[model samples]
Target: MKVEIWSDVMCPFCYIGKNNFEKALEDLPFKDEIEVEWKSFQLDPTLDPDQTKTTFEYFREKKGFPEAQAKQMIGQVSQMGIKSGIKFNFDKALITNTFSAHKLLHLAKKYKKANEMEEALFIAHFIEGKNVGHIDTLVAIAGSLGINTDEARQVLTSEEFNDEVKNDFSEAGSHGISGVPFFILNGKYSVSGAQPVEFFANALQQTYEETVIPLKNISGGDNSCDADGCSI
Candidate 1:
């Protein structure tokens, strides 16, 4: 079974969703056959990455939320992260556009390190307060993953993988997905938001079983006599 996740690195719930789904996969009976593909979704694509505004400031100015309310929201999300074994430090988080980060993610997917890239990017922005939108920071992150630093930088410096990122966005739009942490299982079953671990486990189990077991064939089989001789 294939699971496709559409999320943004800057979304607090997206990281939490990642943890929850991963926990479910750990216990999945057919985990070895499951393929996970992380796609990109920008919550605010028009935001300027080079702006001096902080995440809290963006919330206050752009979203029109008061400082107290923003802090409360972050606190609540942080509590959710704690349950998922994730440490979120929103106080130090940066506010920047994630388009470049998404492009880099596409590159990581090519090398089969997209999951690692996503996790590292999340930690960098939320916990370490690193500038994930910066090219240098992304190149360093890729290097840590054993990806060729020069090659990664070359991709970042150029317009590489931009179409791939855009394609993911287009696909998300077509799926009517307007939020982060949206998960699609086998392109059939979809679970939105950071649901509990049990929800993910059940979805995984159901998809696997339905795919492996064929539905009853109610159509006619080989011709046979039924109360009379069958005619060709």
Candidate 2:
């Protein structure tokens, strides 16, 4: 089974969703047969990559939330992150464009390390508060994933994988996905938002059963043998 996740690194719920989805995958009998692909989606594509606005400031200024309300909302999200085994430091988070980070993810896809790259990007943004949009940070992340730093730098410095990232954006639009952490199981079932582990597990199980074709008993019981007796 293949699972495609449309996520944004800067989105707090995306990281939480990732953890929940992985936890669900852990107990699956067909976990080894599952393939996961990370697709990019930008919540603020117009944000300047060079800007150094904190997430709190973005919420207050851009989202029109009051200071206290913004802090309270962020606190709530932080609690959610904690529940998902993540430490989300919104105070340290910078609101920079994730387009470059998405491009780097496409580069990682070439090495079959996109999922690892996504996790690293999420940590950099939500936990470590690193500038994921910066080329230096992305190259460092790529190197950590066993991807060649030079190649990673070349991709970041140039327009490499730009189309892949844009295509992911287009695909997300086509799927009418306006939020992060959207999951498509086997290209059939869609699960939106950072749902609980049980929700993901149920979706995975259901999708697996629906996608996998059952063997047809052409002979029926005419020539079948039972545990108690054989049909002769």
Candidate 3:
């Protein structure tokens, strides 16, 4: 009933995976009982904050792909995104370190809006062409979402939630998750990458079959509980 997802703000696939997961949940029979936990994952901790190139140029340089090829890849991803009701201008994205952003996400969890903040940050970076790595810009986005801007500004300047974010990082490492959008369901099964909705649904069903349905068929080991009574 619990799903933990490890993702990065700067990663495009993380956004795509979010869409896929949302779509999958809509069709899940027990959607109302599901709990979603967002874990912190940084794709590039050493990203230079002063880099002025657009996101596509950075990808082109870092990935060694020509500008034309970069644009083509962006076009492909954008088309895929359109199918899922997301619009991403990946070619012109700006890259930066997401550690601080992860810190804010951790802070947002206390307010029970971590999921919204996560999705907002993704949209800010990929769609609106905002510099999500900048604290001031981040505060503005958080404020627009009705989050306390002053508190967010203070947290951005201070070390608050730093350790919590780091703990999520450590947790991901302990789980052997090495990439963004890695998913763990019920702490028993894991599916890596931005998989399709059917893949997640099938994985859940398969886990239930292998782990839950059989137990339901077990004979009278605890008939008292089923009878809603206790023997005194």
Candidate 4:
């Protein structure tokens, strides 16, 4: 079975949903047969990469949320992360465009290191507060996952994987996906937001039931063969 997830690294719920979905897989009977493909979704594609504002500032200005509300909102998300065993340092996060970062993800997908790339990017942005839009930082992250740094730099320096990122965005639009961390299982079941682990597990179960062929008698047999003789 295949699971395609549309998410943005800058989206806090995406990371949380990822962990929750993973936790659900742990208890799933057919977990070994599952394939997860991460898709690109940018929350703000128009953002400037050279911006020096922090996550707090971005939420306050662009989102039109008051400073107190922003802190309270992130505070709630931070508690959720802690419960999921993830540490989020939202205050230190940098506000920058993830177009180039999404491009690297496409490159990573080519080398079968997409998951590693996604994890590293999320950690860098939410925990380590690294500027994911920068080429050097992306190269280092890609290098840590055994990706060729020079190749990564070359890709970043040019318009490589740009179309792939845009295509993902277009696909998301087709699916009516307006938010991040949206999961499509087997292209049949859709689960939105960071739901509980049980919800994902139930979806997996439902998919299995719907897809697995059941054993049934198609015909009646009138004759049988025994060990010593054949009955007619």
User: Candidate 1 overall Cα lDDT vs. reference?
Assistant: 0.80
What clash pairs does model 1 have?
none
lDDT tens string, model 3, 69-158? 767766766776787688887655777777878988987898898899999999888988788879998898778778899999999999
lDDT of 4 at 213: 43
- lDDT at 231 for candidate 4? 22
Worst 10-residue lDDT window for candidate 4 reads 221-230
Local accuracy by lDDT, each model: 0.80, 0.80, 0.74, 0.80
Task: List model 1 lDDT by residue over 14-106, tens digit each.
Answer: 888899999999987789999999999888888787753576897788778798987776777778889989988877888788898998899
Alpha-carbon error at 102 in model 1, in Å? 0.6
Q: Model 4: per-residue lDDT, tens digit, 1-232?
A: 9889888888777888788889989988799999999999887877898665796787777777788987886787788789877999987899799899999999999999898898999999999999999999999999999999999999999999999999999998888777767778787767777766777788777776786443221112212111121122
Model 2, 181-205: lDDT tens digits are 7787877777777788888888888
Model 1 lDDT-worst window of ten: 223-232
Model 1 misplaced regions, further than 4 Å? 211-232
How well does model 3 score by local distance difference test? 0.74
Error of 1 at 208 (Å): 1.2
